[model samples]
Target: MESLLECIICKEPYNQSNRAPIILTCGHTFCKSCVHKMSQHSQYIRCPIDRKFESRDLSSLNMNYAIVQIQEYERTGILAKERCKAHEFPIVITCKTCNIDCCPKCIRKHLSHDMYDMEHPTLIQELDNSMNGFEIKIKEYLDASFSAKNRLDKEISELDHQKVKLKKEIEDAFESLMRILENKKIQSIQQLDHKIKEKEDFLKQRLNDVNEQIKYYSMHYDEFQHMKKYYKESTFIDRVVSCRNVLRELNFVQFIKPKDINDNKLRIIVDTTPLIAHSIGSVSFNEKSSSEILMEQLNFQIEELKSNKLIYNKTNPEQKLSLEIQSISNFLCMSENIPELAKMHLIECCCNEILGYSSLKLSDHLKQELSKKIDTESLFDTKIQEYIPTLRSKLKYVKGLIYSLEKIHEKEWEKGLYVLHCLIINENEYDFAELYLQIALLRICSQSFYIINQFKVIDALPLVDLIKRYTKFHFLPSTMCYKQVMSSLRFAYKFVENQMPDFFFPYFKTQYSAYLTEMSSKATENIPSEYPSELLAIFQGLDSSDLHFWKDSDLSKQFLNKVHRFKEECSPWFQALRFVQERGEELSDFELAALERSLN
Candidate 1:
């Protein structure tokens, strides 16, 4: 009994602190500190009793409150003896029929009940066997839950990583397109400016020539008048004769007019049809990628489990146990069921023991049968055969819609719109269809905003329609949170509605209210200026060549010390610098230069 309350690893009794008993998924209890130490050596904990690997976080392990209670009872001598309420006689016997402890005087009341000595070896062995069986079932359930959770967690993480990758791809595609458009715009403007300058120069030269002619003609007229008024008749006659030849020349000259100036207009006719058709790059999904394949498999498994039901009802005890097991298995698949499920398992075990029936063995058998039902491909196929084709078809159609949307072609835009409308309207009929639709719509809105802001080739009508549909469908407060969804929505709103929605700014402000408050408080507070020991170590280890030339001087140490003491107070900046310093030779010169420039 004493050994039962002690940790196998440390051979110490359980306590509330460091020696607190924690049960692993394998149903083995050990001290918290011992488990923590074991977990440090590996990603998984290998149960010392069964040598089974349980991939559970040490901190998440359930504390064995039962053991704690028992230990406390033992410490207080509460389990040492029990007295009958009426006779005040010591209770040393258990009424097996009633499943209760009783004194000798109480035996008269339970005369027809089957009684056993408290210290009877056979009774003790029976109790231990029953407990062992219960433990086995509990372990099986826990293992299944842990396995399902781990797989789900891994898949979620992979999808998240894929989401980030896809976002970057979209950004890169748009950035490249924007660059091309920018270059074309600059070139067009330059050409237009050059043509205008050429036209202006020609007009200026022609005007100057005409003005010279006018000045000459005016001076000739004035001279003729002066001769007529003041010169001798002979001189005036000679001037007239000289002017006669010039007048004949002027009559044949034909002065420049507006019509003769070649009034051709320069216009830029941009044929955006071809650019719109081909310039925007397409987004695509590899349907057969490992992640996609895994996702499909997981979806199939989840669907199969959800559809599964026990063939029998609770009238039969064995079937009741089976149903309980099935129900627990279903609950265990969910992330939030661990605490509740643990308590339920404990209660079920206690109930089974008190009932004096070996439901544990029955539960174990049912568990195996359930496993086979779930695991056997032929059985699963037979079970879900009716809806398989329909499910596949729906998935394929959704994939096609996603592919068309990703192509970013003007022709496909309507098709994308149609897909979104259908998805939103029939969202209830499909599993994960709403999620896919939401993300796709958000991406479209984001892309539309990019196109309008950068090139204005694509129409904003579709973007506006999409945003309206998104809002009408109440797609805000999406599974993808505000931070992710709002950025795209805000940009789309600005382009379409010309103003941000009331929800946008407030959502962000409220979401980051705490962070903003912290920042505001920090802005007014004095921060520590000295570098932490870890940072100081990193600074000292940095290569001398990477440092400035002044580092070679005798004042280098003093300079470094002074800089460390008072140069800056931003912890994040210091951490980033320390990270860079720690990387040392791993970072390239260009990367280092970029980091330095960023820091500056």
Candidate 2:
């Protein structure tokens, strides 16, 4: 039996000494030495059994370990069957109860038990039939194993080939990109040269024109000197008249030199430092997304598999799917090392485990399966319902985030703002964060304004306290907080004006005064020193109605002072001063007097 497992070419029993047994691509087993000898002629060696070509060489072939184990087991079974342990005589009878064969002399001890006679002709024939059936089953298992392995080997080879092709494609793409950039660089240089040449020509023409004018003037002066020194009175007078007529005939050409076009330095559209950094970062990000890049490669691989008819499903007999046991193994074997692929495999595994099934199901069957997994006790159970209570827990998650940030700020506000800024920026990088912020803001807006309207809810903090919490957390360098928390403040303020007049009015009045102070300081700096006609154009466009809100505070006195200072320094401020002066109804008597004094 062991000799049957020997290599056909080497005629040697499979063992480690002969490099055991290994199967070629053609499903032929051979000792490693024989395969090596065949591979010496070419990498594509023919199988000893089928004369078919094997793409991989001897070293890369998979070991036939099952055959080797079978050979060892057969050799052990032969030795075990050589003699009986119960009786030393030539064993003939078999005791089925003890599972022992014995001589006829020892068989009398087992007469009362269930047993099989080893020497019975019918029993031996039946055993031979059973052995034949076992051989057929073994052959079927072997065929299936070899077929699965062949598909796996082909897939691995294709994956490697795709990797090489994709690498070349990336290299070509970068080379093409470099070529385009080089062309653009040449064009930019040529454009600069053209501009410089144009400027040079203009300067040279002005220089020649100026020199011609100087030469004409010099000749006329020389002629005058000669008349004064040597010419008679009548000749000098006639010459003077002729020269004056000539001078009148000469056209006056004003040569105004062009201002310097630009200093001797390079000017580019945008500083490339940030652009280059962004480009490098984008490349690194693309490299990290290799799985997405390989999606196109996977499509090509699928096409190749279709050509080979290696469809993974089992609706057709050509497909050999052992999904019940090898689904996970098969999935991972083909899938790239990507988290999304792993997640899909996990979802499939969980479904199979929970439902005791695989693949598609009818709607009714799916419902039945889902019913088994769901809790059906109560309609209001949290597992099956939505529960929203009063405002403390309404934005619990957002409130927690604010509280955490406050704790960090207690350590140091600067560091807290830095951490908060980092978090916000990181959140912006993902698509989901915007939705998260929007949902949180919606809940907050609804709850805060709802409480402000009710006023006597008696369950939560005031809108002012919530607004303060939001502002305390809003001290970020980024404008994101202005759009988020400041918008919330606007909503609160809108509600506060009508709902809680005393607290809201006082708070708003103070805030408005501070805002005016800051505006005055900024407007002072931005106002030009020696006001150009451009200031008159700017002042003409200012609408007095826009400043009507300033009447709500006493700070209008200081704001009027700022306008008066501008009016005294520059005449262009006259229109703006008059516009403010005419809004006499909105201004206090002191502010009106100040405006009038400025106009004077």
Candidate 3:
């Protein structure tokens, strides 16, 4: 019974007569038919004892002769019995994947070390344990990853909590500062009130004197008439002229006056340094705001606020202010419409900061994925010590940026916004785009919006894009300018409108048809005419029925004429194009029914 061969799959003994050609290894054996099938699958003999990923060598497995030798005396089982080659024991044979031996006591021990255990243990666990150290390493990596993820979650929670708290504190600061703004303006408010009060006091005094004289005159008129002749000598009884000058002066009745944000700036636009005259509006007052006054007030307020304070650097005041600007959204626009502008500025800056942070974090993923594609030398750039003239010159460029942003606050809407627009129009460089967007966000979109008209060139379509980006602002491009830009760009203005609806929506908002008509009527006579033909054709065709088309359809020319209202053909296709687009619906059930009815 112990001299029997074991099956690779079943791991049990079978009779010699039933034995098949097999390979043996580690005292385990499997049938040749099974081994041959397994060999075809793998380049190296994968241990059936432990079905780990391994190659199978077909040349090494000999099956037919071994099976034939065992079965030669299968009719006489005693003759077929063999001795163990390594030790003096009755022999059993088997394939390499599973072992069978005559020595039962040693078999149990050999089975204990087997990659796939037969009894008292699990085969899967032995196979797993058989892996070279990578399993432990991979397990450790996964564990560490989970721990890190947990830590990251906690960190994110803490950061979100901090963000909320910071936001609250920032709001509290804004609210408090707004109160200060109102409080400070009380002085100006009082000054106007004082002027009105002074005028009233002067008028009242004269009225009181007039009443006194009138009362005296009523009682002493006859006596005074009697003395009029004697008083011709102009002695102690000299008649005093009634103070009618008071009545005349009192005629200057003061009217109530309402001031805008510009009016409040002197008192409310607090700063750490005295604001330069340039910081104020285009229109000047009798008195310019003192730079010292602003500096002292802003410093005190900054110090008054919890640890965060607005301060001026001894060397670079602009850099310091720019940095602090990230702290507050409230900006002092040189215009009267400051509160509205300030609200917009604050929201934009906060959003921008969040965007920058998010993108910076995501940038790492891009670097990892694309690092293989990137150049090792260029990216690593080990030639730092050998800074040639070209590199040295480029290195000097950051100073120029510092210079640019330093005096940025000094610029007003017209000059500043134009400069910003000109700087941002590049489609080539990302760094340029970043700088442009940053500067644009910092500077409100009031003035550059107008200056876009100055560049009526067909190629500078980016101006239209910029206008689209800042849609909330009032920007009215001429119909000609729009035509030129869209025509030159090979895309319709509606393409931009559709892609960037949020930006253009405010300009084309509802309930403004009257205003639009009024503005159109009032527009200058020489409405420039760079007619884009394709746009006209589309609008004309869309106005027609049956949104389908054919090869010869001059829909392009049709769109041009129809859109610009230049001309339209009397074709049925043109008429149909107008019909479907006006409905702005696809071929629906009702439309289908209408089409069939029309055909019938």
Global lDDT of each candidate: 0.51, 0.45, 0.38
Q: List the residue pairs that clash in candidate 1.
A: none
**What order do candidates take by lDDT, descending?**
1, 2, 3
- TM-score of model 3 vs. true structure: 0.21
lDDT of 2 by residue, 1-600 (tens): 656588887788777555567787777788887888888987678876677898875657776756755765676753222334333244666777787777777778888876776768777887899999999999999998997787567657756986898888878878888898789778877987887777687768866777877786677667657645644456465766765665564445344454454673434343557646756322332343222333333344334334333344433321222221122223333322232332233323333433323323314443343333232222111211111111112122222233323433242332332323333443232222222233233234335445545553232234333323333333222234223334443444454557565745565546633433432231222111222243234434444222222112233233333333422433322332333346422233444334334533
lDDT of 3 at 275: 27
- What TM-score do all the candidates reach, one by one? 0.28, 0.27, 0.21
Give me the runs in candidate 3 sitting further than 4 Å from their true place: 1-172, 175-179, 212-216, 223-377, 380-600
Query: Stretches of candidate 2 above 4 Å error?
Result: 1-81, 103-111, 121-126, 156-168, 203-600
Residue-pair clashes per candidate: 0, 0, 42
Q: Given candidate 3, what's the lDDT at residue 87?
A: 46
The TM-score ranking, best first, is: 1, 2, 3
Cα lDDT tens digits, model 3, 176-208, are 866876886786578767766776776577667
